[model samples]
Target chain A: METAFTPFTSFGGGLAIGLGAVLLMLGLGRIFGATGIMSGAVFITSRAELSWRLALIAGMVLAPVTLFFVTGQMPVLNVPVSPTMIVIGGVIVGLGASLGSGCTSGHGVCGLSRLSVRSLVAVPTFMVTAAITVFIIRHVFGA
Target chain B: MKLFYALITGLVFGIGISLSGMMDPAKVLNFFDLAGTWDPSLAFVMGGALIVTFVGYRLVWRRDAPLFEARFRIPTGTAIDRNLVGGSALFGIGWGIAGFCPGAAIPALGTGRWEVALFLLAVTAGFYLRRLLAPMQTARAAS
Candidate 1:
């Protein structure tokens, strides 16, 4: 398989993500964890906090279309998993995120930035496991 | 005001994820394939984000309060428990299988893909499942 390495775009996009996270922290006093925000929007009893959560998710959903207008091209997302596999993956991710209390953005980006010890442990654990899974699936299973 | 800020932050985050090609599962999976055809661009993405957020957090923490809220809602957990490790391990496997973390998955929904939709549905179900299981665990502990 050919490798696709685009450092410029990746770095630029990363900066934007960091900026977005910082903005959320400084402006709203909230951690920019997608799962947390999404779950809050879905399950929270407080109606007052719902609007911002909905807005954030709506913005995320519309971003691709907004980019389409700016760049005249849609993002290419090639998910190489079957429908069943995708559903199973999603369930595990959702459950794990809830139990772990954060996802990539929460634990990987924000938590690391804050120098949290638990995130420090969680990030490496997940990254290593992710690598192992990929190795098994692609190399051993040859899927 | 808070809603506006959240919307803007989320939009920027979505665009960043799209531009960084993090939304592409193949690229994400390639990053995990270190022994095979490894792409190190994602590392740069994380690095760039981490640096900005590291600095951003330090500066933001200097302020007494957020611009729009009374207090910052940072995580206070400090334990390295089974839930953290086990949940992270499960999340990593799911991420490796699908290459779609919560951040990327939310934005991918804009593409209107059936697989994305299915995965999201499963994610919601998983969230509810976890919610339902929490009380059972509490009951068992109490007993």
Candidate 2:
């Protein structure tokens, strides 16, 4: 369960993510909120909206393929939780994000960058809860 | 043009996520587990992203509008209401239960794992459920 600090790689990745957000704002005048984008894709409220959402999602799905070409293999990610837990957690996240109108990418990243007061409040609220949840799951339930 | 630009933007974001180790649910979970073998790497991802996006969005905002869009679609709401707080709190619980945020989980779908697929499906159902319950909330507000 021990993990080494990954400052260098994490920073490098963060920079790339920042650049991507910059591109969206600069080019499309839009925020790069993952949940919002995906929901918009799911609902497909407008034809104009569909193009950008689908395009963005396609690009997201293609990332591993891009990495495969670069590294000659797929990147395997660890879920670290039970399948039922993943589904339950995922549903809660989905519902919560919709109700809150943003998630980490939306409120934590892009929203904070813009200095939105709502995001400033939101980022901490979620961080605390997530930490508490982890505490309960790991220590109390010992999952 | 908007679609193309969005696609490329998504590409960069997805690649950044893959590179940053955000895809690893354990890595993310450890960040929350302060009493355990905590990994502080995820902070850098948010920090690195904020540095660029903070400056980048500002620079972009100086422009009259984005290249592809006629206007910025920035969120107008600023109130720190119950919905914002409560929804985010719920999301935090879900995130703690599973380290996979929507941003991380969506791209990991490329792994073609049934777990990821099911998790996402559950998330979609949650969103649909929320939409179904929205009228109740609206009616309450109207009353």
Candidate 3:
């Protein structure tokens, strides 16, 4: 499939992201952490908050799906890993996001912007672990 | 009311990222294809983020306190020691290996992209490692 991904398009995307992140922080006094959002949807039993959580997630899932329909341009990615590896990987990330108390957006973007020491620590660790894992998978294990 | 605002704003943010092309992993992957063709998309995204953040931080600082909170919780410690350097190095390595950082990876998963799942798993594992070692690191510091 032909793709027209360009830097100009990304600038528009970045603007939205920056604005949204700032609004969330100022409006709700909460951080934008995807792992935390997922965890909240699953673990939070309060009915009052459930719909909002689900909506936030639905928005995330739906936005791209909708875009794919409108533009006929869903991102094309090639994955060489088996389903078992996928599950293992998801579990690892879920745990890491939880332990870190934020994902990349929370720490890397929002937290880093705030100069949070904890984020400074967590973001780098996340980056290094990802690199080493990728190396091992592609080179040594050939996964 | 607060929750309502959060949901609406969050959805808008998610969609903005998608439409702007920041959430599309394939576009990001091109940047990692440094040997074949230099993709400048990453720079745009970073530039956009920095621009927004530069202004947003200043605005936030002048407020005397966060809009929804009693105070802005800046990190107290001023020292740039081991934790700072080590974590940052690790994060850069992870980003180098997996083109997807934490925030982007979460959205990518919605597209049924399994590589993101793998990346997430590593992120989760990293989180746990930090948690498990936190106590020991603190103890070692005391001794």
Candidate 4:
């Protein structure tokens, strides 16, 4: 599929994300980090703590499905990697997100917004590395 | 109340991710492809989110505590260690390779695509594996 820059959609979606994050912080007193929430839902020892996490995941899983009903179209997805590459990428992402303590949502949006110093350092590191990796794969290897 | 709040937050977030075009791997890849056909839409998404959260957090922090929680569950780690840097680098490479970060990946499952299912499985495995390895790492350090 051909790529296009969508400023309005991006901005609108961003506004929703920001509103969601703010609501989470104010209502639940928690950072809206996907990996952290997922991990907690799956691995937490206490069942009480698990309820909200599961609710969050359930809501996320339902959102696009709801959108499909409302708009009569499935959300656009463009996974361009091979099976092997996808597995490798997914594993690395899971491990890295866990080890790094946050992903784009936690570090990039919420953490940065909170003015966390660690997130300040992390965002640039990942962004630059991601840029270089894309350059290597797209230009150098020509994959 | 907290569960309801979490559900709403997740719903908003999922919608935002879908609308922002972040769910599209091609768009995400284009964002990373600075030297190629770079699309800056994700920047606007991030910018919009940052502005809202930046202001919203300050307003929320003024409160003594959240409505449903005792206190905020904020990360307190301040040190910049090898784990943070290395993990972030790994995440960046994975993101560059697959164009699916945690935030995008979860909601992508709503698309019911095989590739997304595979990626989700790998991500779950990666999270569990990290948990499995954490104890060993701590033991090795103690030894």
Model 1 C-alpha lDDT per residue in residues A29-136, reported as the tens digit of each score: 887888888788779878778888888888888888989999998888887788888888888888888888888999999999999998999999899999999999
Q: After superposing candidate 4 on the true structure, give the runs of residues whose Cα lies further than 4 Å from its correct spot.
A: none
B18-95: candidate 1 lDDT, tens digit per residue = 888888888899999988889989998898789889999889989999998888889989999988998888889888
Backbone clashes in model 2, listed as residue pairs: none
Tens digits of per-residue lDDT for model 3 on B1-143? 65556656665566556655555444543454443333566567656765775577667667666565566644355455565555545554445444555566655666876566666666666665666778998899999
Residues A1-143, candidate 2, lDDT per residue (tens digit)? 76679899899889988999899889888898988998998998899888988998888778878988998877657777898898889899999888888899999999998889999988899999999999999999888
Name model 1 segments beyond 4 Å from true. Answer: A1-3
Clashes per candidate (backbone, < 3 Å): 0, 0, 17, 0
TM-score between candidate 1 and the true structure: 0.96
CAPRI-style docking class of model 4 based on DockQ: medium
Q: Select the stronger candidate by TM-score from 1 and 3.
A: 1
Across B18-89, the per-residue lDDT of candidate 4 in tens digits comes to: 889888888998998887888999999999899999999999999999988899888888889877888788
What are the iRMS values of all candidates?
Answer: 1.1, 1.1, 4.5, 1.1
Across residues A44-98, which tens digit of lDDT does each residue of candidate 4 receive?
A: 8798789888888877878898888888877788777889988888888888888
Q: Rank the candidates by DockQ, best first.
A: 2, 1, 4, 3
C-alpha local distance difference test of each model: 0.87, 0.87, 0.59, 0.86
